[model samples]
Target: MNSSDSLKLVVKQQNLEDISHYIYAIVYPIVFLLGIVGNLLSSLLFSVTKLNRTSCGVYFLLLAVFDTIALIGGLHHCLNIGYRVAIPNATYCRARVFLVYVSMDMTSWMIVAISVDRYLKVKYPITARIYATQKLAMIVSSIIMIIFIVKNVHLATVFIGDFSSNAADNCDANPLYPKYVAFFHNVWPWIDLTTYALFPFLIVTICNAFIIHDQYKRRVKLRKRNLDRSLITLLLVSSISLILCNLPITILAGVYTHISTSTNTND
Candidate 1:
């Protein structure tokens, strides 16, 4: 590469980094505040209403908690990337990264639980009422949390505080653990894509489809619909929103991982 070409490339990279920092700086705080307020309102609503008495309510209440934790984890990362605040220690770095992944995984599976709950309610109302108790929801949620914690514990050991001069380099894979680092970069993203996006998307889609079909059948029969239409509507909307929001990122991540793997192989 010529000197002029190298200079231009350097400037371009710098500009891109600046843009990323600027975006994060502007976006993260706003998102954090809004997310906090939203979750709080949701919790309050669940508490005040009879919703808390049901399995779906249990899922939602826990969802708010998980979302709040995920948001906090994101803000920690944003501070490092957008405001030049460094992670203070290795332990903090590991904990922060671990919590972020675990919380996110929890959130994803919690949604799946909610979808399943809704499916049972819609498809087999009598059976659901008999089996899908609030106690069961709590047990299921706890199981999901524990599973994700175990699944993501490796994140705690694999990540270390990046002591680099650049603040944007907050936490990175520990070089001493080559196998783990390779897994983190080369394998983990795909696993995350499946767990975080693809799997949830699939479950939600199938559940929503059944719910929709059941609703249609009810309408056709002109039977007084026993299921709560509003809740069903809400489920449909949330499922669609999740699919739309997650699909692009999931596809992009998959493609990017493939390209990166190919590049690393070539090198």
Candidate 2:
């Protein structure tokens, strides 16, 4: 084709890609709405009801709260990006990014807390009494929230816009600080993967291992087969669900980073 015709062809291709992205964006709001409603109900059930005030119940309540934030902050952003809302201003963009990171960090640490709490209660019941109070858990969660917020403030400065010739979507990174922007945008998510995903997975693994070991010992010593079987099954089911819900998101984040980098390099 002639030069003008070739240019028109490329522009047409870009337009098609943009249209596809726009359609994919619609799925996010649906997911976000469902997440918000479900988590809100869970939070209310755990928090308001007198019968559900145990340590595990409290942990679930915190999980629901974090999930709600994730629905509002993270999923809602997906909706915005899908809709191509005029998110040109830095202030609002940063706020949205901040909320997303905070919610993610909160969710990760809350799961870790639950694993640790379960470990203590299962293996060291005496120490669990001192370390596993609702107050202490809240304190630890608060500290995690502060650290995540301060650490990810850089994300707030990172705007989603053109960075290279190949980029189809605007990414999040501070334009002024180009030196560290790439590192934060491309590398920092890996750090989050480790801290928020791998570490918690390890903790949960160890905690469950110990719980199983202790239960086996109890079953052998007491010979209470029926009761031991039921309890172990319940614990196993809960742990599996937590891992399942968390693993996909972590893997997806890593995959997305890789895909973005490849796309940028190709462009």
Candidate 3:
């Protein structure tokens, strides 16, 4: 394209991104409110429901708790990135990013734990009894949370709020590693995309597939009746949702890696 055309293209792209940012600002606040309220109600319901007294219910309840935290982080992200509401507070900037990632990581891993617990319970009913207890679910969720918090602790230091700088007023983590910032931005997101998103997606899919197959066998080969298809359906739906929700961010990470780092002009 010619220079004029190129300039128009860049401006158009920027306009679209701005439009998307504004849209996100509007939508995410609603998302944040609904998420908090819905998760709270669900958490209470799970805690009271007799079905949640089981190992599976415990996992679901913990997932709800993690999701609630993530939703709070989501509000921070929407306000800060979309509207610059939290950009002035350095502590909030740092803490919000850390909490966002850590909570999201735990959320994904908890689903993994849930899927595995269900798979084992169906695959090895007797052996799974001791392994898939509420206590075990709690321990696993806690460990996963701890591991992610430790892994992402560097976020707090990296994300600084320095209004003195001429960089945009948005809450972006400055490039601490100046020369390597582009490379870092390009690669680090993928590491998260892999460990937190892709890995959990693959694990959940495999576990749920096995669970479904086992359920089918029990129904067809063994002449079993009264199968609880609801649980299986829930697992399938969750697996699909994880992939669908995360794939876009993972793709955007790559897109940002390419565009933001090409000239070291953005973060």
lDDT of each: 0.74, 0.67, 0.72
Q: How do all models score by TM-score?
A: 0.82, 0.74, 0.81
Query: After superposing candidate 1, which stretches have Cα over 4 Å from the reference?
Result: 1-12, 158-168, 223-236, 244-267
**Candidate 1 per-residue C-alpha lDDT over 174-215 given as tens digits, one digit per residue, 9 for 90 to 100:** 677777767776888788888888889889988888888888
Error of 1 at 222 (Å): 3.0
**lDDT by residue for model 2 over 76-132, one digit each (tens)?**
336433543333445655676677777877787787778778878878888877767
Residue-level lDDT tens digits of model 3 in 1-267 = 899999998887677566646755898888788888888987988898785767888878888898998887666446544654435566766777688778788888888887888788889999898777777777877788788988888768753433332333333446665644553455678788997889999999999888877787778776776567797778779899999987776676455433322212333
Collision pairs in model 3: none
Off by over 4 Å in 2: 1-26, 51-54, 158-171, 224-244, 254-267
The worst-scoring run of ten residues by lDDT in candidate 1 lies at 258-267
Better of 1 and 3 by TM-score: 1
